[model samples]
Target: MDSMIKTGIIELEEMEFYAYHGCFREENVVGNRFLVNISIRTDMTRPMQTDNINDALNYVQVYNLVRTEMQQTSNLLEHVTARVMDSLCRHFPDIEWLRVKISKMNPPMGGQMRNVSVTLER
Candidate 1:
């Protein structure tokens, strides 16, 4: 008998954080709510067959990485999102594709908008 190879998508969605990130001085001082979402495509064969954490993408580690990056203050959501994407790629070379999104809730745009977001996919 032979095992089959397969690819799978893993997602961590709506990971919330309260971070000080913005272009305006007041916005930074006041801080705001944020959401980080990530999607990863990778080889799932080993993890599926072995049913072991070592063979799979450790999402807890991924969440930690996102949290670490979010804690680092930045002037823009784009920069934050990019840092997350870069960190994940650097740490997990096995990922076939990656997508990262950062959302700033109730942004200080002087309007009733829900949120502003930046997304990067590769």
Candidate 2:
């Protein structure tokens, strides 16, 4: 018999917020709907065996961190996404990999685009 370590991914998807993040002044003032998604990869061996929240990555804490980052105004989606990734990595030292996506809905680009999004992975 052999013991194997398992890798697990915990994903938080489509978390929505109304934030003032944009290049335009009107966008900063009026704000817009935004969606955030995060995926974190970590060792799942302990959590799988013990079935304990403490042994696993806490999603509530993840969400709070993402929310805090989103609340800070930024002009670029890339910057926001990077901030989220940085914050997550800082808070969770055990993370093997992380992916973050930020989408701005109905952007003021003078076109009929649904949304503009930025993604960062590390």
Candidate No. with top lDDT: 1
| lDDT score of residue 57 within candidate 1 | 95
Q: Candidate 2 lDDT (Cα, whole model)?
A: 0.92
- The lDDT of model 1 is 0.94
Alpha carbon lDDT of each predicted model: 0.94, 0.92
- lDDT at position 113, candidate 2: 95
Candidate 1 lDDT at 3 equals: 62
Candidate 1, position 71, lDDT: 94
Query: TM-score of the candidate numbered 1?
Result: 0.95
C-alpha lDDT of residue 56 in model 2: 87
Where does candidate 1 stray beyond 4 Å? 1-5
